[model samples]
Target: MTKKNKKDIFSSKNLNKNPSEKNTYNIDHVLDSVFGKEGTKKRELNRKKAMVLFRAEDLINERKESGLTQQEIADKLGKDKTYISKIENGKVTPSVDLFYRYVQAIGKRVEIV
Candidate 1:
């Protein structure tokens, strides 16, 4: 058997595209070509993350409004104050159940929209 040439290995035809043009690797272009531009992969991911951040911020504000110290809130949630701080600071993502417990500890109701 003979050794393959470097050019043969690096050629676009050997890979995934046409050798003649530039390919735009933007999320929109990729999704449009693969799944369709109407695909919600990017938007859905961002929206879900934004919602979690919004919920965390709301919980922090509510806790402040209720005049409860972080330690107090932590005690109510059966967690450490550091954990409460992490949630409030957006250092960690809380589960739906934990979010509800946080809101309740802050003397507020968790409303899902």
Candidate 2:
């Protein structure tokens, strides 16, 4: 038999379903399709959200583990209570140095691996 054309190959029974439309709940795959393989504005926004959530959660957990309140953390960092609130609420993105300071205030050190 002759080799199928590229269109014919892609037009196979299953290839018609787009990756985003497929029912796979895998986050990476969904993100790849939605944001593109590299990244898009929408994807970058979503990435920011995810990063904020992660950082907030990390901060919250560290504070809890160290038995410190937001006020206490702010005191340690010489910041206002609202500053801590904003960080924990994902309403702010801290600079790298500020993040290090915040994490240190909670009695933890940042590790790069």
Candidate 3:
């Protein structure tokens, strides 16, 4: 084949036609391209969202471990159960003080790293 034909055959656009093609579009690569490098402005937003999700997951797990009902935790925190539910669902970011209180209430240690 001519060089131009070889290049076209190896291109990502043509990979779909060849099931055995080794070099194809990578989802991670595409995401990186769209979101920019980590710590960059675009990725910072993604990082914040991920942190909120992690916080929510941690809160739920801790509450379960402490055998606390949602209402109970809410009562201890002097907040509404719906507010706690929203935080656990990652619908909102809890204030630092509130987050610390949550950890304390669950008898868990909060490590800052």
After superposition, candidate 1 runs with Cα above 4 Å error: 1-38, 111-113
Clashes of 2: 0
Error in Å for residue 26 of model 2: 7.4
Can you write out model 1's per-residue Cα lDDT over 12-62, one digit (the tens) per residue?
A: 554555446678223343334334346468556656677878867877788
Model 3 misplacement above 4 A: 1-27, 33-40
Worst 10 residues of 2 by lDDT: 1-10
Single out the weakest 10-residue window by summed lDDT for candidate 3. Answer: 23-32
lDDT of each: 0.72, 0.76, 0.80
The lDDT of model 1 is 0.72
lDDT of candidate 3 over 25-111, digit per residue (tens) = 435444455456766888888788888899799889889999998899899899999999999999978898998898888888788
Winner on lDDT (1 vs 3): 3
- How many residue pairs of model 3 clash at the backbone? 0
Poorest 10 consecutive residues by lDDT, candidate 1? 24-33
**lDDT, residue 68, model 2:** 91
> Once all C-alphas are superposed, what RMSD does model 2 give against the true structure?
10.8
Q: Assess candidate 1 and give its TM-score to the true structure.
A: 0.53
Candidates arranged by TM-score, highest first: 3, 2, 1
